[model samples]
Target: MPSPTRPSSPPSSPSSPALPPELLLLVVDAVLPPNPLQLLPASHPATKTLLSLTRVSRATYARATRLLRERCAFVDSARRLADVLLCVPRLVPGLPAVLSLRHMTALYLSPFGPSLAADDLPTATRVRELLCEVCETLRRLVVQMPFGSLDPLDDGHLGVRRTLREGFEQLHRLEEFVCLGSYPALSVPPEGNTDVWRLWPELRRLVLFGVPMDSHWLWWDIATLPRLEHVVLARPVGLDAVNIKDEYFHKLPRDDARLGRDIKVVLMDLVYDLGVVRTERWREIDPEERMTVEVFEVPLPFYGDETPLQLVTEWARRGALDGSVWRLGGTRVRGEEAG
Candidate 1:
């Protein structure tokens, strides 16, 4: 009889090599996407996975802290920021930099009260100072202005801009920009707000929610922006639209080499003829219509439903179907403002 064979030992698992801090951070970026935790609710498995990364190592913890700090949507904006950040420093070991918000990158601003109130001025100023400090790294930004009140001198608009001009001009790196609540009647005065939108050569995408796309020079700015590739008018309800002239479409096969790709403009509702009312029906759209108009629904109005970052992400993916599948961009903060 053959001797009983000894039980075979199970194969041992290989240990992962220790990655350098930079590589480790890159790994975290690839997996977690800045602050993926906010995309999911607290009890969600994905949120748990992202939150778990905070404890993985000293390097990851620091990155996580910065990600959290980048977009702090306080039910109360003032004390909440300091209270949240001050407590975190003790938890993240070895990285002293995480304690200071000097490395912070993004901010979300929403005006409070019926109109910009006098008492709120100090808070607005404080927020603006914070924006100035982070101007170097800040890329994606969200500002909520009062509806139908974007007139340059409106006290409410003035109240929010207490810090806007000072810090906004400094954001040379500002890329994806979003302004919510400003309807078609509301507009960034071209004369007063030239620096607000025009200065950023790096700006590729601009989203204006609840905006009226008038033929005014402000709407026409889309054509002049050298690097702008996409413009989205969420909840747009205008008889007409502004777009790259129809002449460009006819020239596509020949001019595509020069045109490369036409800047895509989207609307939430039908494209009305330039002077038509929102309710007017068109038997047929004229072939000469200037914009490449597609009808897309603005994300549903619900808390935690859509974020400015998420809106940009969707537009980016649509603009380049074969290129970047933007699952999310910047640090998403479930919307503080609504259309």
Candidate 2:
């Protein structure tokens, strides 16, 4: 002990054991619930949290990044939509390689009018190219038209409209397609053929917030989709937007050879918009057949977390008398909840 022993280094405390990958995934799912049909907006708090998690560690980054890409990527502007095609790091902590766009399966494109930039032409083209690139993998798509219409008369933001029209033409593998905000006159394909059913042969669910002008095309198309199971016609405007007539019923698949599943149509009406009702009352419009129509009096506006898509899906599931008032918000207040 003659020589003073060098001060012993303080014992290092053991780092907390890393969370199991399974448990970590559970936490991630809980934080950002997986909704393939729902788009995770980048501005959303949950989305921001998930983006931050990508930098936590290699393990967390990989899992979080994977989940983000798998879920619907919300694109609000031309530039933002173009970004999805880029090979740059989506977030900081650039330890990992750039995310590949091939993993994107769902996409929501919402172009705001107020924020429209003059140089959007090139960006819009890139997005169209991006859609072509991911067409095979894209399964669910939601296009929100805030200030423009797919109709040529109210033609505004033609680029975004073209993107939407072309996106539909390209992404034929879609299972679910939703149009929010203004009326998207997607009834007729851009090619002028009224046979719009060919757009998404694999489509199962269609939620249109605004009905198209050519309601005949809408009816005709619904009859042909072999895989179509659900159709939500919300806030029907004009005289015959969702006018379910005997002729329309006649178009329905009469034989089992054509329709393997029953087609459920939910005609949704908001509290504000009041318009002509072609059918004042409808009861099991072809109960014996493969078509069933239900009219829902949606309690709230088509905004917020409880979107028209979520409400119509819940309301349509309730097996009630066709045209009965199935109040949405809580349990079936006036109808038989489906067993």
Candidate 3:
């Protein structure tokens, strides 16, 4: 009854040793390395792990946020688009919150919904707002809006160039610009003094899908962008009839021919008849030419479920579409073309 020995408490459990700050940072880097080529989807295991680490501590979040920003996903749908926009209000009053729009490096804009054109009123406003938010950081942008949608966004007065300039000109750091879907030449009336291409001083790669093959002015815009190196003219199958004139590439003007360090004309679906002139042109290019044009025919069937962003990221990751490199003028062209 010595006061029941005061019911002595059990010995406290020992805690694990804290890792050094530098060591912790090293571990984080190992877990989430910088990937310039591809942006993993949010559902990916590595992406999920990085997101979980953001909540561990302030120190971890400080480092993880920067790494997270570099590997953001391709924004494609209205639902996914909303997810990024939802977090915009937490950090800054009007600015999009980090871990989503503000941190995004790649963006793919297509028809937001079955009934909604990308430029339909409120949708256009949202896209413009989102672009404004991410302009400072966005590096890759892929646009796949419906035909004539750009003109309607600005009351059908200014044309596609004006619409594009308003939404995209601010992205000074944009490295890759891809425009997909059928459309008239964006440079209809000429660029005048304010060349839109010059706005993206850091642009390195330009991919045009379904843009008319004869859009010489659009092709010449590449010269204005000092840093542009690679240009891809991808003609997917099932589009409107291909009205390419004979020797279209061979007769390209000297200045327009050298658009970039290397130019690639890619024809998906492997239409042998359609690719003949392009192949001939590719073979005709002088091996000593300062700028080279390489033609490719890939057997990419219709990707009903896939978005253009996925297609482009696949191309970027492998340096060729779907790992099947079919140089149109080379020995392997027919074998791949037959498929």
Give the top-scoring candidate (lDDT). 2
- lDDT tens readout by residue for model 2, 123-148: 54665677787788887766654424
TM-score (C-alpha) between model 3 and the true structure:
0.67
RMSD (CA, Å), candidate 2 to true, equals: 7.0
Better of 1 and 2 by TM-score: 2
Q: Write the residue-wise lDDT of candidate 3 on 215-327 in tens digits.
A: 44454455545677766666543333432222232345546544324544444323352344332233334333334444454445565555553454345334421112222
Q: Is candidate 2 or candidate 3 better by TM-score?
A: 2
Write down the RMSD of candidate 3 (Cα, Å): 6.7
Candidate 2, residue 223: Cα displacement in angstroms equals 0.3
Q: How high a TM-score does candidate 1 get? A: 0.56
**Global lDDT of each candidate:** 0.49, 0.58, 0.53
Please list the residue runs of candidate 3 whose C-alpha ends up more than 4 Å from where it truly belongs after superposition: 1-3, 33-35, 92-104, 114-119, 147-165, 180-199, 236-274, 278-287, 300-339
| Candidate 3 lDDT for residue 150 | 45
TM-score against native, each model? 0.56, 0.71, 0.67
